[model samples]
Target: MYRAIRIHGYGGPEVLQLETLPTPVPGRGEILIRQEAIGVNYIDIYFRTGLYKVPALPAILGMEGAGIVLAVGADVTDFEPGDRVAYPTSLGGYGECRTIAADRIVPLPPDIPFDVAAGGMQRGLTARMLLREVYAVRPGETILVHAAAGGVGLLMCQWARHLGVRTIGVVSSEEKGELARRNGASDILIGYDNLAARVRKLTDGAMVPVVYDSVGKDTFVASLDCLAPRGLMVSYGNSSGEVAGISVRMLATRGSLYLTRPGLTTYIAQRGALLGGARDVFDLIAQGVLRVHIGQRFALADAGAAQTALETRATTGSTILLP
Candidate 1:
């Protein structure tokens, strides 16, 4: 038997329960992974609180993890026992061990630590999708990133900088602002108040061509206002709350802005895309252009506490759970 955090219903962090279950076995095209590290992310919170629907009751809640392959199932050609692998988009990752579709797993380089891979894989892939695929952020262009000290934000900041894009990062506090700056934010704005004005000022009144906002509700309007005409507003998350009650006129009034809510799953649904994006992110890590910080870690049994900390925005960079 192995331990896992399972939730029967949606609510707060208190709903997460640790329990023991029989170790899962691999089926066709699947591999059994002995999880070394689990990633804690806001999406897990979303599923926990019923913001994102759970597929079933008593759900094991997590989407990413790194581990060693203990076994491989029939017809799996690319992996074998003892492979170091990590997945960015699999459910039921908050466990000591679980079976996952082999295609969803990416082999990790020997030099990349399991903890770092767990913390960065999902967020790094997210940053790659947003910057490379969503709107194709280009050199010499200025962009605004919300929650700049957070996991995806940090990666986006650094990767964008590597590509010669200037980033204007918005964070909740001065400390987070400093962290964002250290991660390659050309300018930092603290708080949501007068966000458009601050962004405009930083960009010399021209505003930015793109605004990658994950804060939602509280900052969606400001994010729209921060964009240059016909700019793209990539609203990828809802840390504050979901954006609602908006009409097309809002976009028209705000410089013909284009809005998108892209998911990493959609971007990497194909096996080639999945492997290619992960390779790009890993390559960046190997080059030292992207630095991943695992700012908080908790024992797997303490996932509830980790979720609470994440919900309250108490952690920075990436949070991981050790099994």
Candidate 2:
């Protein structure tokens, strides 16, 4: 038997329960993984609090993990026993052992450690999708980022800098601002008050072509105001709360702004896309172009605490759970 964290109903962190279950056997097209590290992310909190629905009750609650494959089911030819692999977005990750679709897992590079792999995969791919695909940021362009010291925020700042873009990062405190600056944020704003005015000052009143906003509700309007005409507002997360009660006319009034709530899954829905995106993320990490900070580690049984830390903005960089 192996241990897993499961939630029977939606609520706070206390709803997370650790229980023992029989080890799963791989089904057709699946592989049984001995999960070494589990990633803690805000999305997990979303599912936990009923903001996002799980397929059923008593579901294991984690989106990403790194592990060694111990068994491959029938017709699974690409992976075998003892292969080191990781997945960026899959349910049932908050367990000591679990079976996942084989195609969802990627081989870990020799240079990338398991902890780093688990920590960086989702956030790194998210940064890639936001920077390269969604807005396709150009060099010399200034962009605004919310929660800039957070996981995806930090990665986005660094990756954008690597591509010659300037980031105007909005952080909650001076300490977080300093962290964002160290990770390539060209400018930092502490707190959300007068956010657009502050951004306008930083960008010489030209505003930015895109605003990457993960803090929803509280900063949505200010983020929209920080954009240039016809700019894209990539509202990818909701750390503050879900964005709501906006009409289509809001976009028109906001200088014809384009808004998108893109997730990593849609950006990498295909097998080729998944492998390609993961490869890019791993390559950048391996080459030291993107530095992943494993800021906090928790025992698998303490996943509730990990999620609470992430949800409360109490942790920085990446938080992982060790099994």
Candidate 3:
């Protein structure tokens, strides 16, 4: 038996329990992997808090993980036992091992570590899609990245810089601001008190072409106001809380902004899309351009505390669970 963080009744971090279960067998189009690490996002907290409705009780709590394939289904031909892989599965990632659909798994770049690959998948892939598909940033264009020191934020800042785009980062604390700066944010703003004003200043009275926001609620309106004419508001995650309803006219009034709520699953709907998008992340990692910060780590058994820390915003960078 192997221990996994399983929740019988979703409620709070306290409810995440470590329970042992028999090893699972892979089905057609699936592979069983012994997880080396689990990537814990605030979305896990949302699942625990009932914000994101999940299935029946007693479910394992993870969306992404990295490991070595232990077994392959008879129909699976792309991967074999012992291949190092990482994946963003639809569910059940907190286990020591899992049977995941092979297409959801991607081979790791030679130099990337298991923890880093796990750390980078969901967030990094989200950033990749946001930049390449959501609005398609161009060189010399200015963009605003909210929570620019967080997991996805760091990747966006670096990846955008690599594309020769300038970014004005929005962060809560000074420490996070410094982190965003190191990650290639051209400038950083603290708080939403004078957000649009700061962004205007950064761009010399001209706002950015796009605002990538995960810090919803508190920053949504200001993020909208900071956009230049026809800019896009890419509201990817609700780290602050789900964004409230807005008037349709506000989109036109606020620079005719385009609002998009994108998730990794939607962005990679095509099998071809998955491989292409994931390859971008792998290439960035292979070239040493993407530096994922594993700022916090918890043993698989300590998933509860990790969830608590993430929910309270007491942690930064990518937090992971070592199995």
- Candidate 3, 1-323: lDDT as tens digits: 78888888869788898898998999989999999989998788888888887787878878999999999997899999989999864589998999899988888766889999889888888888889888899999999998888899999999999999998888889999999999999988888898888888778988888899998888899989999998889898887889988787999988777888888888787778878877888888888899898899999999999888877778778999998
Query: Total clashes, candidate 3?
Result: 0
Distance from true location, Cα of 120 in model 1, Å: 0.4
State the RMSD for candidate 2: 0.7
What ranking of all candidate models by lDDT puts the best one first?
1, 2, 3
Write down the worst ten-residue block by lDDT for model 3.
307-316
Q: CA lDDT, every prediction?
A: 0.93, 0.92, 0.88
| Poorly placed runs, candidate 3 (over 4 Å) | none
lDDT by residue for model 2 (1-323), tens:
99999999999999999999999999999999999888998999999999999999989999999989999999999999999999999999999999999999999987889999899999999999999999899999999989899989899989999999999998988889999999999999999999888888887888999999999999999889898889899999999999999888988997998999998899899999999999999999988889998889999988988988887788889999999
> What is residue 26's positional error in candidate 3, in angstroms?
1.3
Q: Write the per-residue lDDT of candidate 1 for residues 234-284, one digit (tens) a residue.
A: 999999999999898988998898989999999999999999998999999
Assess the local accuracy of residue 134 in candidate 2 as a C-alpha lDDT between 0 and 100: 90
Q: Residue 168 in model 2: shift from native, Å?
A: 0.6
Q: Which candidate gets the maximum lDDT versus the true structure?
A: 1
Instruction: Give the Å shift of residue 29 in candidate 1.
Output: 1.3
Q: Clashes in each model (backbone N, CA, C under 3 Å)?
A: 0, 0, 0
